[model samples]
Target: MRLYTIETGFFKLDGGAMFGVVPKSLWQRTNPADERNLCTWTNRLLLIEDGNQLILVDTAIGDKQDEKFFSHYFLHGDATLDGSLAKYGFHRDDITDVILTHLHFDHCGGAIKRDGERLLPAFKNARFWSNEKHWEWAINPNPREKASFLRDNILPIQESGQLHFIKDGEPFSPNIDIRYAYGHTESMMLPQICYQGKTILYMADLLPSVGHIPLPYVMGYDVRPLTTMEERQHYWQEIVDNEYILFLEHDPINACCTLQHTEKGVRLKETFRLEDMFG
Candidate 1:
């Protein structure tokens, strides 16, 4: 099995929103804010190459939104899905599965693309995987998260007849298992992979960055903040016990890290690039 960190691009978000109730003074030390109180974050995705299947974790924000819509988030960086895939000698067609962690625009936007005047599946041959509950929640989004679940990024896969869903607690691949959490969004599936003699958990929005290692540092966008605290407590314990790497999706600078017990509970131990671990 092989894993590649696919860099789609970087965008900005209000640091306060990303840090939840945590005060800007505290979070700014870790994720410094700009004049606009926005912090740049990486739209990092994961590509899993196991045997004959090439599964992509989350598709980063695609380039389909109009300039007015994109003006809100300052998108930067030269890395793109096509360029990253080509570097690995593959293309969108080579992806057999596109596992959306959730239907948030940043997480699933690249799953679809603009084709002439219509929206369509970006990966023509890939079976887009999103849990049934998440699919529904995204489609009928609540007022708070409605802005983030753009219909253009979703709807296309189902319309194209390429959408699929895995049962909760089900295994996604031989080496990967699904763990469901409701704090970030209903049925947010975090992929637990047994790779290189260690367990790695995709941090998704449940834990967006190493700075979010603190249990109370939940994102304000989460529908259930209290549930997030409980989930983080349990997840951090397991992370420390198993010495698992937390694969961050939005951390601008760091890619992966392990945790250890701290005076304040479990906390980030070491940060490293993905390739450094196995190289």
Candidate 2:
């Protein structure tokens, strides 16, 4: 199996929102907010190539939104979903599966696109995978998360007859195992993969970046921050004990980081591009 980092591009968000109650002095040193105090973050997706099965982990914020809607995020980057796929000699139609960690707009927006007056799955041939709990939560989103779960980007997958849900512990594919967490959102599925005798866990929103590895770095967006803290503790110990590679979804610079047992707590021990590990 081979994994590729599919960078969908970068966008800005209020640093205070991204870092929660963490003071500016601390987060600014790492992310360094702009004059407007908005920090840039990369919407990094993962692609898995195993024989004829080409599975995409998540789709970054799609381009189907209106200009006024996009003005809020300040999205910018040379990399695009189609361009990145073509760079690796593939196309949208070649994708067999799209495993969405959650239905948040920034994570699965690119899974569908606007075609004329109709909304449809961008990869017509792919079976879109999302867990049942997350699917139900997103479908009937509460007021707190309504803005993040756009109906246009979501309902289309189900209407297209391509949406499917996997059991929490069921294997999505031979190359990937499944783990579920509910702190960030309801039943967010994190894909844990076994390759080369080392595990790589996709830290969707539960741990968006290495900075979030700390227990208290929970995002303000999380529905249940305390539950998230427990989940993080469980995962962190497991990752360090097993030497797992953590794939970040919103890190501005680093693609993957590994954890180490620090004197104070578990912290980022090393950062490397996914390609660096392949070499």
Residue 267 in model 1: lDDT: 82
lDDT of 2 by residue, 73-126 (tens): 999989888888998999999999999999999999998889899988999999
lDDT of 1 by residue, 1-279 (tens): 999989988999999999989999999989999999999899888899999999999999888999998899999989999999999998999999989999998998888889899998999989999988999998999999899888888888899999999998679988999898899899998999899898889989988888898889999999999999999999889888878888999999999999999787888899998899977
Q: How high a TM-score does candidate 2 get?
A: 0.98
In order of appearance, the predictions have TM-scores of: 0.98, 0.98
Candidate-wise lDDT, in order: 0.91, 0.90
Stretches of candidate 2 off by over 4 Å are: none
Error of 2 at 168 (Å): 1.6
Clashing pairs in 1: none
Q: Alpha-carbon error at 95 in model 2, in Å?
A: 0.2
Clashing residue pairs for model 2: none
| Candidate 1 to truth, TM | 0.98
Q: Which stretches of candidate 1 lie over 4 Å from their true place?
A: none
lDDT of 1: 0.91
